[model samples]
Target chain A: MINAVKREIPEFIEGYGKVKPFMGAYANIGDVVKTSVKIKSVKPNDKKVLPSIKDALLKCGIKDGMTISFHHHLRNGDYVLNMVLDEIAKLGIKNLTVAASSIFPCHAPLVEHIKNGVVTKIYANYMSGPVAEAVSKGLLKYPAIMHTHGGRARAIESGDLHIDIAFIAAPTCDTYGNINGVEGKSACGSLGYAIPDAMYAEKVVAITDNLVDYPACPIEISQEYVDYVVVVDEIGDPKGIVSGTTRITRDPIGLRIAKLAAQLIDEVGLLKDGFSFQTGAGGTSLAVAAFVKDIMKKKNIKGSFAAGGITGYIVDMFEEGLFKALFDVQCFDLKAVESYKNNKAHQGMSASMYGNPHNKGAVVNNLDVMILGATEVDIDFNVNVTTGSNGIIIGGSGGHSDTAAGAKLAIVVTQLTKARLPIIVDRVTTVTTPGETIDAVVTERGIAINPRRQDLLEKLKDSNLPIFTIEELKNMAEKLTGVPEKIEFEDRIVAVVEYRDGTVIDVVRQVR
Target chain B: MKIVRPAKAGTMESNDIYIMVYPNENGNEIQLDSIVLKQFGNQIKKVIMDTLNELEVENALVVAKDRGALDYTIKARVETAIKRACE
Candidate 1:
């Protein structure tokens, strides 16, 4: 089937049944209701503790081909996924599907499980490191499925991806299974990604290194959703859970791109009283934060909030009274974690509240400006964060498309070329975020506003910064580095990239 | 001209390349290791050879460890290493 974005997709991929090609960026994906697993809770006085991870799995009814879920609040320091999967593999369970919120470098051991057929399928919002490399090489038995942060929540809520058991890595949990991310050695700030899993999965287990007394303070995951509690020696390394600080790029090219992006936001009149903003933790994007903060301070304009993955820079801005509040979905650094735990204005939000398009109102909807990173940007402004220049699975649209669609001004920041391959191309290897939603492309060479945004074109016409058409930027990149040769692919599909609406935007074919 | 001194440029970070140039009797000999070798190995080697030729350094040992750096970054680092080697 040929979709709106012009990618050819089979109606049914072998592993994925009856694939639905993406129709358009904002097309409504009708909702499917779900029935929760019937639970007969233990008496109020009964013990809810489990002895070990293996015993917990055994009680969750370990079997072949059942789906299990995990959250990535611990980021690269996470031990729960590996710990649980190891036990599942040792128990001889095969063909299990793992639905993790995100996969990082530390989870490389998953490649072994895929090789042994203990795990056959994967579903996640983001992936990196050795496991990502293995999937790109077609190591798994079934093609992996990638979704946006909001789409994952939609899928879980609609029962499209039913999780038989969800193992949540809680930083702090009381005897009664009340979980909190603060007040623990491995405090990570917000347990946003785990909320949906705890609420919707058939059985939910809270794994924690810090076991507190009855009634844990400020429960992020309520005891009502938890089926059992397992106290472990350690949940994760706090240092790995949150970086000391997310620094800005010192590279001149990156700095130039970031500066232009911030200026564009100012030109669009987004830097005003009560403004809201979000930016990725990438070097260039963080540089944009620094630039924007300086501008806000210079202009004496206080913002309403800073949203998305909260970094120390954003926390610094809040501490400086640049913004009135911070709507934190997840904290990215120790400073942000400290703010979330102590600051009255820094609030924890569930993933659904953060980016779920189906929700009544998501925080992204209130964003005035959002700065994002892209692996590739086509002439049509379609952004690809899913695959590399060689069409390997290097990343996934965590909130790339979600914020692009929600924010009033969505700016994509990237170098014109990466590794001799031009980032601006006639077409990207995969379309992670459709072109219609993006507002502009900010590169070191120049800025390219989407032609659809005529207002932006007119607004930037008088600005001192160089403004060029998307085609012109592509040409300029080609002049520096010759046009990249087209990449070839095999007939087999290794992974599927889903838009925020859960339709297949593009598929990663085996790179032969 | 021949390289008179040993010098290095770039770092080991991802999306970067580290290069070391040393004076040698061998004619523009190169040693390379890269993460994206299967895809861009030839392009990388071509960039190094072109840079060395442009600088007129015929007798030098060029060693590069790449972490998926692009053409521009590779060119810039190579030029810096060559200049340092000549000094």
Candidate 2:
């Protein structure tokens, strides 16, 4: 029984606060179970078609004040969340709680539902755009509960968040509910974010635009967990799955930054065979991959694997035999989705399996190098990707700190300045990734090795790349462009920035 | 494509500056009085000069009201302005 809870046992035991079991209570458990009446499984009738979403909700016993869940695999393209909530609103459901993986700008429709008293509570890994703006304004009746990607998984598994119905937007699903993200027209890549939701929800509904024959290949979410299958005209738009401009930087400054990052990795002796690397699909980070690819080709060395949100460029490297395998938590583009469908070596990984620190051996633990982006990097190497200079919540730490903390070498690639604002500051607006995890900071001007990494500093001493202390880099930037004016922020905290390990790193405030 | 003539210019000095405005095809124009443009002059000059240097062009004055123009879009407008100046 304790093993079922696993990592959560300690918390549960703490919450119990000295409830001691009787001495003979444990001994009689087996005999008591044997004397109890046995119940057989009653499968649903085969001839009945799954009802409409509204009818399905009624059948699933959905009522006011119940919590419903949605996955964010479709990201900005997702239409299911709003559509379902619209139906729920029409039904006059009030005080309902929405537990979604993450909420994007496209989820602005939800603000109306919140205003109409349909949704009173919300829980998500991240929130941005108008939804965030609405939350900041304190429009909702309840304060939104924010969790990290790993934290959400832990919460669901521990039964802390008991979801009544999980509305999973499957890119592809069979009538029997064997679903995968790789097959359908709306293939957005791996159905990683939905795995935990489906497993823990009392009733799981698989909504898909594409209904395949009998059994879908590569069952990401199995039929055993799914209770209902509903086919719709469209689940999501594939184009919105991958943002435009996931290309290498053509700008000289951005290229220089990428080159510096790649050289720093090589200088640290991490470019040899059997190495593993992970980089975000950002432009500068993709440029780093391009440079690393060239160096690997020139040296004729192959990597063990490349992990994280897989892009077509990484898929191309896999096809070129540069890496042994690609461990993809999510697919970021059409090519990656296609490769995920056909390629035997490409494997999908769940969020828990990818970055959960409590896990025995997550994929991030084996990463040799990880290139990340930052909105602001302090002299201490603490990186902030969550807020802008004005303390406005512009972005969220989506695996930035997770990969940085787990990887052997974490390199932060950023331009020295953006839109006349210096990115290297005395203190970051928010600390998403702590300084201890970050090894080096690469900028268009120069590279800065963290003082803690004496080994890396010694190794790169003779390298051609210009290396400077972080303070020195800041001073140089100030010399080139006069000291930037500090932004004034209001007293009210807009949002709390959460570290991947579920700690509150910092809070963002509205710009004054 | 309404191309307004460059404002009658004085010598390019610290104080004297030429402002060229090009309205979009939709005829959407953002008004910028001399005072507002002067406030943003230094930063705008740096950005335009840096882009011109990067693109290897010279002798252009660009005034743009970006509704939602990207970085590359800004560069293209500057380049077109430079070509017009040369002609």
Candidate 3:
């Protein structure tokens, strides 16, 4: 079956089961009836604190084939997922599905679990490192489900994802199960990604390095949702959890593309008062934000809010009064964590409210512009952040599709060519974000406004910045780097790339 | 040009090719590892083989690690390696 993006998908994927081909960007719109989780009571005399993860697992009645969930607030620093999985393997559990928000290089042990049949299936928003490479080689028993950040939250809330147990790596937690990301040694800010898991999972376990006194102040996930609190020697490494500061790109081409994108946004009249923006943590994206800062500061434009993963640069922008408030789904750096703790303006928002299309209104809907990075952008404007030209899983769409669909002006900034390969291709290796949702693509060669965005095209016609059609840009890039040889893949599917609306946009095949 | 001792040219960097040439008993042995192996692998190998042919590099072992180098860069690196190996 062909999805709306024109990618051929099997009606029933071997390991993924039935396919729901994406019809359109807003195809899944309907009144959602949220499912309720099983309720449990904690008596005043009863205790929630546990001695070890094994105790919490036994207390939760965890069994083989149960779906367990984890959040990526600790990022590369996270040890809880591996720590618990090691215990689970020791207990000899089989066929368990790990529904983690994201997977990093630190989760390479997951590859071993996939090989030994301890973990049969996996779900994540983004993936990288050895586990991703192993998945691309068809190591997992089932096809990996790569959902967007918003889609993961939706899947949990809508009951599509039934997490039997959720293990949240809390930076700070009380003996009674109150939890927060701040005020601890690990101290990863914004426990936003873990909220839905805590709210929807059958049994919520709070794994913390810092076990404070009862009634832990600044409770992000209150004690009511947590069933067990386990104190560990360490939940995560502070150095890996948060960076000192994220720097803008120093590459000349990257800076040029960023400049062009920022100029395009300003040209479209979106850089004025009350402007809201979102950008990823990529060097180019950060550079675009830096360029936008200059424009905002020059005109004394007081913007509304900056949304998505909060970074130190964004925190500085908010502190400088460039933006009125910040909507944080995750903290990328330590300064942002500090801002979240002290400043009331740096708000913590759940993954659901951040970009879930089914929600009443998400923070992304209020975004005036969103600058993104792409591994490849096809002539149709469809972006691929999921796979490389060789059709291997390098990364996944964490919030790429969600913010692109919601923002008024979704701009993708990239160098026209990369390492003798063009960033713009005749067709992307995979479609992570469909073209209909993308408004523009900015490359060092020129800026191409999506033909569908005629309003932007007409507005930018008179601008000084170089503007070209996507076809023209592709043609120029191909001139430098001739059309690449087509990549071959095995018949067996490796992963399913789901759109934010819970439909299959594309499927990745095992690399031959 | 007759091959003498083992010699190398180019750095392992983006848009660059690292070429190593050694004297061999057989005609030509070429081994390549490239970033653009999926796409331009055939083109890159052809360029190296053609460049070796032009230099009359018979009975030599050629190894190249390419990080998406252009045709001229690949040719230049191969030529430089051939020159250095002969001296």
Candidate 4:
């Protein structure tokens, strides 16, 4: 089967079971059934507290070949994934599949477990570090599964992916398993990624450093979903969980790209009242927010909302009355965490509500503009944020394609060439976000509007910025760097890159 | 021309290169290390040697630590180090 992006897909992957080719941006839709269910009978006197992770594993009836789940709100500072996996490895548990929301550098130890056969399969939204490298080298027996934030939720809800137990890393939790992300030393702002796991997992164990009195304040994951609570020494490092401040780009080229992106938004007339925006936490994307802030302030345009992983810059904009509200699925920095904790306008949204296409309505669907980053953008406008020029998996489409599919304008802001390699290529190594959804590409050299967006081209025609066709940009980049040699890869699929609609967009082969 | 003094340039940040140039009597030798060596090592090393050849530096010890910096950035940082070495 071939997906919308023209990537071939087998009917079945060894570990992942079935492959679904993306029909279209909105063509894939069906009735989503909630498959996870647990026996409700319980004793009133039953103590939900567990002595340690081992005890929690014992109590949860964790066994070989069962699918265990985790959330990555802790980002790189997470202690829960390693701690839990270490206990499982110690217990000699084998063939356990891990369904984590995202995998980070701190979870690199899982590479050893994968080698040891303690863990066999991985399902994640995003992944980086040593494990990703190992997977790219074909270390795992089966290719890993990558899903979008919303796609993962949809898969879990639709019974495509089932978890036997879910280990949730909570900042604060009560005796009865009421949890919130804003009360403890490791406060991470929002447990949005963990909410669906808690609600749908057959058994949920709330792992926390701060075990407070019953009824944890502002419960993000209510007691109804939680089955057990385990107290750990530390859930995560707060400093690592959220950076103290996520500043804008200092690089002149990055600033220029951001300036053009902001100007494009203003020219498109989406900078007026009730406009909603979403961007990444990258330096350049944050700089776009800063540049857009000046425009909003100058024009007195109060936007309807700001969405995705909330940053301090967006929080500041919201506080200054630039936006009416903030819909945050996760907090990327300390200021965002603080704002989510105190401000009424700063609301936490579940992954489903954030961008689940299967859901009734997503915040991204209401988004006016989204600023995104890319490792490569092809002549077709297909963006690759998943792999490097060397074809190694460095990132995944967390919300990259989701918001692109939803937003009125999806602008990919990146340098023309990164590390001597042309970013505007004839074909991207992997297609994470299809070009059909992307409206434009903003680089330091020039801005290239997608040929499909005639409306946008007409509006930006009078603008003073250098506007070129994507092919011209590609030529210009090639002329500067000369054409790069083709990267060679072995004939083994290391990982399958899934589109936002849960289809195979590309497959990363073994990098020799 | 020989480098009169030891000079260093660039940063340790990802996608950036850090270089140190020292006056060496042995010969012009470039020592390079990089994270993306398996993928872009050849290109990175070529950029370093090209910059050195362009500048006509014949007696310097060039040690470069790369974090996946591109050719243009490497050239700029190398040029900066050479100018600093002469200063």
TM-score of each: 0.91, 0.78, 0.98, 0.91
TM-scores of chain B, in order: 0.96, 0.39, 0.96, 0.93
Ranking by DockQ: 3, 1, 4, 2
TM-score, cand. 2 vs. native: 0.78
Each prediction's interface RMSD?
3.2, 10.5, 0.8, 3.2
Name model 2 segments beyond 4 Å from true: A1-49, A141-146, A243-245, B1-87
lDDT of each: 0.89, 0.72, 0.92, 0.88
Q: Candidate 2 vs. truth: CA RMSD?
A: 10.0
Off by over 4 Å in 4: B1-87
Docking class of 2: incorrect
Clashing pairs in 3: none
How well is each residue in A261-308 modelled by candidate 2, as lDDT tens digits?
888888789999998999988888998999999999999999999999
Q: How well is each residue in A316-400 modelled by candidate 1, as lDDT tens digits? A: 9999999999988889998889889999899998888888877677788899998989989999999999888877888899989
| Candidate 1 lDDT score at position A508 | 89
Model 3, residue A138: displacement in angstroms?
0.7
Give the alpha carbon lDDT tens digit for every residue of B1-77 in model 2: 23444422222332233334442354223332232232243444555566556655433345544322223444555
State the displacement of the C-alpha of residue A298, model 1, in Å, after optimal TM-score superposition: 2.2
Error of 4 at A359 (Å): 1.3
